[model samples]
Target chain A: MAEIHLDGVAHSYLPNPTDERDWALKPMDHVWRDGDAYALLGPSGCGKTTLLNVISGLISPSHGRVRFNGHDVTTTRTEHRNIAQVFQFPVIYDTMTVYDNLAFPLRNRGIDEATVKVRVHEVAEMLDLVVHLGKRAIGLPADAKQKISLGRGLVRSDVAAILFDEPLTVIDPHLKWQLRRKLKEIHERYRLTLIYVTHDQNEALTFADRVVVMYEGAVLQVGTPQELFETPSHRFVGYFIGSPGMNFLPCRLTASGAEVAGQAIPLGGTVLAQAAGASVLEIGVRPESIRLADGGAGLTVQVRDVEDLGARKIVTCRLGDHELKVKVSAGQAVPAERATIQFNPHLTWLYADGRLVR
Target chain B: MDKWQNNRAWFMVLPVFVVVAISAIIPLMTVVNYSVQDIFGPGQSVFVGTEWFKEVLTDRRLHEALWRQFLFSGLVLLIEIPLGVMIGLAMPKKGWTASLTLVLLALPLLIPWNVIGTIWIIFTRPDIGLFGATINTLGIRFDHTASPLDAWVTVMLMEVWHWTPLVALLAYAGLRAIPEAYFQAARIDGASAWAVFRYIQLPKMRGVLTIAVLLRFMDSFLIYAEPFVLTGGGPGNSTTFLSIHLVKIAVGQFDLGPAAAFSIIYFLIVLLFSWLFYQALLRVGTGEKR
Candidate 1:
């Protein structure tokens, strides 16, 4: 419903932040477009929640200007900003009935009772809470309480966006997807601008149109899930986004290509051209990119272990003190001990000082 | 999962049973023994067969004292609960200032009850006391010794001053237990200050508030030392509550038969009221229409 622009935003809880470690959220700029779903993805203590709070106007950033639709709103309070945030722990008015709980936001904003009733029913219906509309909010299951928290945000018509700070943390595993799908459905029906902050990669990839991966209080990369997989902008993103994350092997540059364990691994001219001046260089490749080459056309490595994961087998090998994993279909031919493996040139990337070379 | 069916766990509870029998049951049984008999001497006594209970129950002065006790407790609760909650809400949430203020608030509650009364006795003297002299200086008639109204006011003031801090401390603990997210959520909902207090704060404080109410009621209902030391049950029995009246029969008159019966009845009355109060509070909490 509204566009949010963060210009040079930085925050530190300390009175004087003299270094990077002192800052809870380091400097950054972003424009969150209107009516788009976005996810802030990071592990705990990575400042994703702090970033969400800054956007919601819960905390005044130490340095920056926040704009809403090109108008300054840096000092606006949360109530005035028209932001609705669902916290990790569900906060419900336990003494009130579910109807009253959902009606609270509208009533607080002085919306008439007639409109409040209609909107409350609409939200309850969308949330599968129609049967519990008349019951008290207390003594319900945690998942139900979480739904009530979400419903509280949905009942307000003037809300510009709904911010979720890991709202599904308390939900049951089976109900997590159901709630996520309900959120997607709500976003589709209303086109509400939503920013969901979660440490879970699966949740972030499943829920958002764009995922912003954060590490150590800084945004590493902002891209779709596919982009994060195929071409991660940062090595941290490469490591964080995938299951059994990307493998890195320290490589030294040569006239032709990079040499890994004294073996020449070919690269595109642009990649080697960019890596020519880097002091620190490494090659990162995913397990799926490594294949068992036929007739010993590649490096012969000692196979250490094979992990069977249903349809595929991951062959972990050691090539001159560097460990590598080659993912293969269960039906593929694999040597019992020594196997020849080759990296897919299109999928493998070169990193200089933990950043992509090209 | 394996369920342990051992009966040896019962022996682990024997120490608690012994401690309860020695500390509570023995003394209570002695009171019950005295309540049913008329003692002529240390070893010679006769079974009174509930005569003393009837006398103690029917005494007009005792009836007045019971009514006075009820009135005092009712007024104390009506004043202390809200005032304590207000103080709790007004206190700083954190930092060194909050710790300092908590220490200052607890100073009144740490004084011994008899010492509180002794301090007030001098502090409320018509001529020598600062409080009483200040009131007289303001052109007000002041004397806790001569007028029943003055004595009642002085005792009520002392009681409130000494016990209100306990309630405030409990309420403060309750308020502090609420998570910060609730306040953030309330702010985002555009809730007014009063609405936040009504819907979020008050509901969260209900459990501690119930404990505060029960403690204040029982403590005020059985109050004795402060009023006795400050007013000496004086000004024609204006502040002589049930405890003071019972003490007067037991110690001042040494009428053991009726005093023992009075003590038993007083205990039962408190137990009954506390049970009734707890039930009412719990009902008010859980009687939601669902």
Candidate 2:
């Protein structure tokens, strides 16, 4: 395991990244500690995969440096970087037996035949692929093939890191959960520096020690899953991280409180200080943070629609003209249409120009 | 999607099947009929059961021609397959160079086969041709007209130059079908260049290589016009492949009965070899263990 550091790394497919729009990955600085499992999480085409590729050394940044173990690896070959990567689809040799496919890297590096067999068997067992080790890979189911792809990455213990690019995307839903759990167990047991890239927040949150939320070519926030859920540094992160996602309602900030659709909701002293405007100031709230207020000061809203997701019910409500969602627990009854729902302002995050005001 | 009852579907496939049956089935029936009969005139004939087949099998002249054809086809495959694959791998992955390379490779394929033979025949003459004059000036005794070895060499060289591009184009298409992620995965695995080619590129190219091999094999086996023009069956019978031998009997000697029987046998051999190639490819391709 090795610590990875990125210092203002920027890249573009075009020669010149003259503007923010030109860069595939915008200039940013971050670090992932040794043996830490980090997930680069974002929507598709949001540069999360690009950042992962950069870390794997398949791509070089147009500016700045990437350091692994305090040594610059910005321009290094992926082979020289000593990392194993599992792609979105399995890259297994279909003609080779499962055992041979797993044993490929070891054999290529000239490991002895007996040792190769032992190692391949061990990885197959860990991945629960031992029973079919003698079978050919081409006829395997997609999920089994994905397991082979994962096992291939995990089999090599000498590598500095293992990168997975949406490795579970091709897997079945139930199998995706099983594989995520297995990856967590593997990371704990071996403590390898594992970097997983995914667009699904649930997968990222469940598998990684720390989640790096990204959007529009920039790393929005890097923190524990709880920290990201509670306090997102960027508005996009707030909107992207949750299932119904965080609600953003346009508002104006004044001395005493913030005005949402000409309604004054008194804010605490701390909340007011964080509500200073730069441009397009808005108030943000996660669904779980807001509730159907009893009689205290709150904004009036009309219920739009309600979604039943088994355990929790998601109520899409309109606060003035803006559509917002609020989550109600399984035990709670959903309010009727045109219900005047109010929310707790203490949990609201004030945003200015897409970033946290303070 | 849509229901299969649409009449347009049959319209799309009818033309192809009609074209194939007309061009292939009719000629094949004629060959089969000719193989089983002895024709004395246009309308007079007598059925001879397997007589021509027995004769062809026993004829030393047919054996020599068959052997020559086999050697030529093997040589052509050996030279073209690897050379084509290497040139394909060397091509640039993207941009104007890729298009330029494709157009350049396609130029030889556009030339008619007889035209290629004519061009090479003139180009390799001992006196009038540029290649012949240049070699003569270099003091090499390269006389193709009377030298069997020289004639064979010239025929082989002409075929290679004329058909290597087809193999190269097919190989390039195969290489292009591979996704970029596979290479990225290899790179991350720390695989050497040769390792990547052996394990990844070569296995992926098997399908295309099969087609290329079979096409080249059939083309080389049936080769007549080029060698006939360039070498005229050579100083001796060194360049006399089976097709040339059949042509000589049918057209030169005007022995229609024997020639027709020989043509039938020749066509059967090509069909048999192509079927064998197909079976071998299917086993390798779809039978890979999972």
Candidate 3:
């Protein structure tokens, strides 16, 4: 297996991109370590698919180079790059049997029939498709067809990496978890470098050891699930990661402390120094990090709506003109009209502009 | 819970039935009537049971015409299908070139059959026409009116020229209907150019190819106008196809009984071949095991 690296890569469908909006992928450098599971997480039109295509050699980057194991392969064709990609929709050869579908790549490489048969069976077993080996691929259900598509990539052991572009989008909901777990098992067993692209946070967080969060056409953060949930590097990451997302309140950094809505709040010296740049300032805290407190203490909030979510409740409150959400456990009492809430000092973060302050 | 049986639905379909009867059934019945009768005049006719059918089937001229019809249609299909698919594949996929190509290809199909015949008649004249004069100027004795081989070749060329575009246009439409993802998948699978065509494009174009085959078969089998105008069944009846022979018997000799019998047999042959072609193509296209 080889580590895939994008060195200052950018792409534009237009011949001459004059503005930032014209570029599909802004210039960025990324390295996917060998044999590690990584997920490129972004919403639609954020260039995640563009980045995947560049890595797979399906499309060449307009600006920079793609290197595999330190060798530039930006202009190499997809087949020569030794990469396997599973598309968003299941793509199976309709005229072939399930066995033949899995054997196609190996046969195209002129692999011997004996070895192809062995590998095909092995992959079919791994994908739980042994029962369908003799069945026509066209007649199979969507999930089974997707399994055959995945098996095609997995059947070849010589591939550098197997990339999945939202492969489970067409699968039934109940089967998604099973298929995902199967993929994880296969990745661990084979030690194959797997890069999955998806917009669903749950899928990205659970599937990848490190999730690369992207916004617009740029990478915002590359961190583990815990790190992304606890310490988001950019405002978008913080807002996009959690269920209720992190709340931001307008604030000003002073020589002595930080002030929010004319009330002085405690701030660490490192955070205060990091926020020293003269620009927009805000304090970000997760909904779960804020606790309801007694009245006339800390920051007072007017309770707007409370949604009971079994074990915990999401308390949406108004502090001045800013809206904040506080997550309280079932044991905590919520006031009808107003409630005082205090942010956990260690969990709270400061932002100068949109980037997180150390 | 009894359902209402609407007897009025039969009345709703009566108009269509009447139109079909007036346009198709009445003419067909008249042919059948003539096939079984010997008409002396407007009111004097003899009931001849299967006599004209036996006579028409035994006619040596009918045998020659039938064989020629099959050979012509077979030649047309063999030459046109592959040539048309190649042209379709060579056409541009997008932009101005695609539009221009489509417009040019559709020009021949829009011309009337007799007009195509008339056009070829002038174009293939050995004395003055461009094609015939050029071949003769090159020192080759090419006269479609005098030589049987030249007559056959000219008729085949004219037929191919007039009808290959229909196949090309159909094949082009089939080629365009395939999704881009299939090509991408084939590339990732490391398929060669031939493999892509064999496994992907050919199978995808099966539906349109069936249409092209059936249409070319039926149209070529019944071809009359172009060959009739170009050679006029000259060179001693070398190009007297089934339809041309039928017209000659019906109109030229006024042998209505035998001509009507020949018409029924011709219709049956086309119907049988079309059904067989449809079944064979459907089986191949779907790759059905049974």
In terms of TM-score, which candidate is strongest?
1
Steric overlap count per candidate: 0, 4, 0
For model 2, residues A1-358, the per-residue Cα lDDT tens digits are 7888999998898886577788889989998888899998998998877888888888888888999889998888877787788889888786788898898877777789988888898899999999889888888998888888877777777777888899988888978888888888889989999999998888899888899988889888999999898888899999889887888888887788778888876676776665553768888889998876433446677777888888998888887789888888877776675555565655677777888754
Model 1 per-residue lDDT tens digits across residues B1-290: 23354566668898998999999888888888998999988899999889999998899999999999999999999999998999999999889999998999999988998999999989998898999989999999999999998998898898888888888999999999999999999988989999999999998999898899899999999999999888878888999999999899998998888998998899999999988887777766454532
The regions of model 1 sitting more than 4 angstroms off are A293-295, B1-7
Taking chain A of model 2 alone, its TM-score versus the true chain A equals: 0.92
Candidates 1 and 2 compared by TM-score, better number? 1
Sorting all predicted structures by TM-score, with the top scorer first, yields: 1, 2, 3
Per-prediction DockQ: 0.75, 0.55, 0.52
Query: Mind giving the per-residue lDDT tens digits that candidate 3 earns over A1-358?
Result: 7899989999998999999899989999999999999999989999999888888888888999999999999999988888888888888887788998899989989999999999998999899999999987888888898888788888888888989999899999999999999989998998889999999999999999899999998999999999999989888999999999999998988776778887777887887887787489888899989988758678888999999999999999998888999999977889998888888888888888998987
Tell me the TM-score of model 3. 0.92
- Write down the lDDT of every candidate, Cα atoms only: 0.90, 0.85, 0.90
For this target, which candidate reaches the highest DockQ against the unseen true structure?
Answer: 1
Question: Tens digits of per-residue lDDT for model 2 on B1-290?
Answer: 46666766988899998998899988877877887888888789999988877887888999999998999999999999999999989988889999999999899899988888899888888898888778988998777888888888888889888999999999999999998987887777667899889878988999999999999999899998888887878788988889889988888987766777888778889999998887787677455433
Can you write out model 1's per-residue Cα lDDT over A1-358, one digit (the tens) per residue?
6899999999999999998899999999998989999999998999998898898899999999999888788999988998889999999997888999999989988889999999999999999999998888897889889999999988887678899999999899999999999999999999999999999999999999999999999999998889888888788998898777888899988877889998998777887887777788889998888887544688778888988888988888898889988888988867778878888888889999889987
Candidate 2 residue runs with Cα over 4 Å from true position: A268-277, A293-297, A330-338, B1-21, B285-290
Error of 3 at A302 (Å): 2.9
